[model samples]
Target: MIKREGYLIKAGLLFFFIFLEILSGRTIFLISSFSFFTTCVLSRQPIRQGRAMKISHQTVVNRIIVVAGLLFSLSEAYAAALLPDKQQKVNQEAINPEYYQGLSPEEAYQWFRDAFSESRKSTELFVLPETEEEISKRATIFNENLQRIIKENAESVSKGESLRLGITAHADLTQEEFQNRYLTLQLPAKRPEVLPELKGLELQQRLSALPDSFDWRDKGVITSPRNQWFCGSCWAFSGTEAVESFHAIHNNMTVTALSVQQVLDCTPKQDGCKGAWPGVVMDYSKTDGICPESCYRHYYSMELSCKKQLIDKCPTHIKVGGYASVPQGDDKALQVTLLKQPVSVSMEASSFWFQFYLTGVFKASHCHTPAKIDHAMLLVGYGRDSHGEAFWLIKNNWGSWWGQKGYVKVQKDKVNTCGISSFAIYPTSI
Candidate 1:
């Protein structure tokens, strides 16, 4: 009977092992399988042919407690490795079809308010329409945006397109309002007299060997997405983030969030909050160099005095050698450069479709134009989506609440979707 019991336990464990094998690569799978295997070992000690193997109730409870503790530790360690900054879990349903499906204008507005409220509960980063008048106006605008989203999704389905549209936090505001407040990328009046020379032959050699997909984030060198928040300082954020990546890649240092406030405060020849080009900001960092967040903090477009006295005293984290500008409208060139490091690029982000974009390869050709780039973002990676649509994964300055946890995948196209290929730039030697 004892021998038969051992066979039964072994058989059960074999089935459990098979179950865990199906979930093989995940952290939970390893943790759970190990815990169960350990429990089995503790519960079923070597039994002499005549004597029954026994595990005390207290011992079993103690073993379970130990296993639970081990599981928690392993899970936390895995999570930390993947997300250093500890980002909050994204509520993907907010952008999902089922979340807004079949809701009327009023109901949709309520859903929007509830979504923001829930987000605020966790992050306190969003504000709701408090006054009755404000609430009514926002509801009306949200209704209009919702209609556009519905129409766009319908058009996408009819055209058999992979592109999708959904309501975002900006849905409560008109496109004009969003543009005036958020879309801020302005070119310098005069270009840099001597543009960085593109090494065409060298780049061509590397292009042939380019991987099917590449992401700097995978290398643990890209920091979490930050919100510019009505700050026309995307130029500063993009410049800062690009510098951070370049420095980490070159020096083999861990990715760190440097101070964008310093860029806004210290960069000369431009109003940091009033909008400036990202390349120029990076050029500024090449000389002055930026400090880490511990030394300076971002105020989200709030006007503040440039704290030069404090910044001067703090340790300079990484000083970039210089920056290079990719040839305008040359996306293939941009792709090769991206393999080396993350690149800074600008796009036209004021259109209704672009403003309310939720997920999927953003392929609205009408809104994209080379001459109309109005926002700055970091081109972190590129790859094909599940449907085989090629896309450029860009990190936006907007908070995690916007677009795929503060990133958007633009459809790779010849026309350059949203002029992403136009005015591309990346930092050089650290």
Candidate 2:
């Protein structure tokens, strides 16, 4: 019979205690990882039958503790190598290069996951790496982007600047691809051949009756933030949200989220996710009205075949006379329209300033060329800035992870900063 002694007694007792703790504790995986099967080491003295003998239980337990400590230290060191020195802070739910430097492959992937929350099913669609080579390439790209942005932002900061850079999800794509994907704005038929400019006197007169401050979002007229994902259906979102707000205010009912998927899928006038004209979207709303988001809420970034059957079972429709054009190049007219309801406006959102706009009323002098009004967004409210400068509060469909939680405030006095006032329009109720 084997008699328990020395190392055996100590190890058995230690394991027994650990077992009890495991029975009564949290994080069983951590505790269980420490656990291992029985093992023996010979004492200085030989055992019975001239063979080496069992270890002292104390020695066994001590050895295990030592090994466990070594493993823990190694784990921490490895993690330190992969992760950033520290998690950097930001105004939004974004991860900038300032947050970390020299991140490993795992860390880079984790960073993307942390900020963008890209699903496992959709991993193949994004720039996530698979092979070892791919991982290295991705890490290099990630760091390059971070360093570039950080350096540029530092220069911007030195100038006593008002805007800052951000590491948006679109940071990975080339500017050309990004523009094509995100800003798919094509003018819809039959509005105007030319948008004439106006003087401030005319603007002041048009906006004379407007309130000093107004925000449809503040008044519960807008929906919660939404993400367009890989889809360029901001046109769909822009028009639908305006319709949503109009229905709420028009019917004197509680504001509810409406479906852009209806317009994305059912409308023949505009392409589904490739891009859409908000004007056509408004026309769709004016004719068919829109389904509530509750009735049909599937916004995979990919476009699908139009489903008229789903439109048949829609929940609510806002009866509208037709789409009304807000005089282009008129901020005051846009403001007047906003005071009553949010307007669907087209703008050139494909600029670096827009991609990384943290806060402050964005100025037009920031960019090189006036980009085409490539994307559409809702002009929800207007108010003076902290310094008494006026700004337009606009809603975005890129989800709350971006800009002021899926919204932006640009300088209002400038008639065409990113072409905000150049292509403004709203739906009129019947």
Q: For candidate 1, lDDT tens digit of each residue in 1-430?
A: 7667755754565455445444332334455556655655664532213345466786567556545544564564456345413323334566554587788867878887766554332222346768989989999998877777888888988997777776665678888888877777897665432233455676677667878999989999998888776658888888888999988888788888888877887788776667889887778877878888767754435446779887877876568878777776777778888988899888888877677677788874757444478899899999999988899999998777677778899888545677887678888775
Q: What Cα-based lDDT does every candidate model obtain?
A: 0.73, 0.66
Per candidate, the number of residue pairs that clash is 0, 6
Candidates in order, TM-scores: namely 0.73, 0.71
Report clash pairs, candidate 1. Answer: none
Error of 1 at 81 (Å): 21
How many Å off is the CA of 363 in candidate 2?
Answer: 2.2
lDDT of 2 by residue, 1-430 (tens): 2333544653554465454444422223234334322222322211222126555776456566545543553454444333322322322445455555566645764676465544222312345546878656655665566666788678777976555666766655556667777777677666632222224565567555667888887777888777776678888888888888888898877898877766788777567767877877777877777777766645656666766676677756655666777666766666666777888888877776777665666767664455467888898888887677778888888766577767888877776677787778777767
Error of 1 at 28 (Å): 35
